[model samples]
Target: NLVPLLVPLFVSAFRRADELAMAMEARCYRGGYNRTKMRQAVITTADKVAYLLMILFLAGSIASRFIHILV
Candidate 1:
């Protein structure tokens, strides 16, 4: 019953695991390497705006749910 529902998720995870293993072997990575990003991965203005929107939406949903439960 629920087994079928989990099949896709399991398959996706297995595929990701296989890809990760291949990546590790390709790099001969024994452990975490301290590498620097060529491009600065800074939070730009757009990212800040998007994050603010996400926070607002999450807060609104939580507040609404709390009010609903209380009522």
Candidate 2:
């Protein structure tokens, strides 16, 4: 049956995936050293403003929901 043929092929496919995963993990472990970041990230005034706005929006949503629940 073709099923018998497919069983080995599936087994080979899964085996290859496991091998690739291990190889990738090993390569990443080795590659993490001697890596230089391209840009130094800094948060500025705009980021602070955006964060405050998001917090305000979340609080307003919660307050509105609570008000609705009481009504």
Candidate 3:
């Protein structure tokens, strides 16, 4: 029942992807050096704090898993 539904859904997705690729190709979008950022990326103090917090959170997560396993 679901297989019959999924086949057409997948076919439509692939067809749309092909169309998008063709449009991007026509516009000469090759990525890498061809791309330019509208705004320059600058790391601020807030960004540094956020990154530090994320790292601490991940480390705590991994440590918790190990602690759980050991106990």
Candidate 4:
């Protein structure tokens, strides 16, 4: 019963995908051809420090959740 309904749905999805691909090809879309970013992405020393601090904080949180403090 469900298979009959799903066959058309699958065909419709594939048809739409094919149509989109054709349209994109017709427009000469080369998928990231000549793509340029306005500002170049760079990871500086400060970014590295921030990432290290984030990792330490996450590790601290996980340790606190699993480790019990003994006084």
Candidate 5:
């Protein structure tokens, strides 16, 4: 009962996917060559400060656990 209905749905989905792929190929979407390289992100002073804070927080969390065990 269900197999007959599901077969056509899958066939149509595959056909649509083929059409979309052809359209993208025509538009050079992620195609080989001539693509510009993305700019690299520079770490600013704020980023460095955030990283320092995160490291400090992690160290404090671990130290607190050890201190609890000692006490």
Candidate 6:
């Protein structure tokens, strides 16, 4: 039961860390306004599908655990 919760939390934290690192790398401290984004970040369909599947599976696992505990 706790596994489902922890896995998603860890994954989210890791993704956030990656985003922070990328933002730091993209930052220019020289106060220059002539820079363009090297890579435009866009959400892909695959990412959306994966996120949905993760949520669905997590929900199912939690529900099953709760039912088991109740029974």
Estimate, for each residue in 1-71, the C-alpha lDDT of model 6 and write its tens digit.
89999999999999999998878778743335666668977999999999999999999999999999999
Each prediction's TM-score versus the true structure: 0.46, 0.48, 0.50, 0.46, 0.52, 0.45
For candidate 5, give the lDDT of residue 12.
100
Top-lDDT structure, candidate number: 3
Residue-level lDDT for 62 in candidate 1: 100
Which window of ten consecutive residues has the lowest lDDT sum in model 2? 28-37
Global lDDT of model 5:
0.96
Better of 1 and 3 by TM-score: 3
Ranking by lDDT: 3, 5, 2, 1, 4, 6
RMSD of each: 12.3, 8.6, 10.2, 6.9, 6.8, 18.1
Pairs of residues at least 3 apart in sequence or in different chains that clash in candidate 6: none
Q: Score candidate 1 by TM-score against the native.
A: 0.46
Q: How do all the candidates rank in terms of TM-score, highest first?
A: 5, 3, 2, 4, 1, 6
The 10-residue segment with the lowest total lDDT in model 6: 28-37
Tell me how candidate 4 scores on lDDT: 0.92
Q: Per-residue lDDT for 1-71 in model 4, tens only?
A: 99999999999999999999999899888867787668988999999999999999999998887776631
Candidate 2: tens digits of C-alpha lDDT, residues 1-71: 89999999999999999999899898785566888779988999999999999999999999999999999
List, residue by residue over 1-71, the lDDT tens digit for candidate 3.
Answer: 89999999999999999999999999988888658779988999999999999999999999999999999
Give the C-alpha lDDT of model 6. 0.89
TM-score-superior candidate, 1 or 5 = 5
Model 6, 38: alpha-carbon shift in Å?
A: 3.5
Candidate 6 local lDDT, residue 23: 85
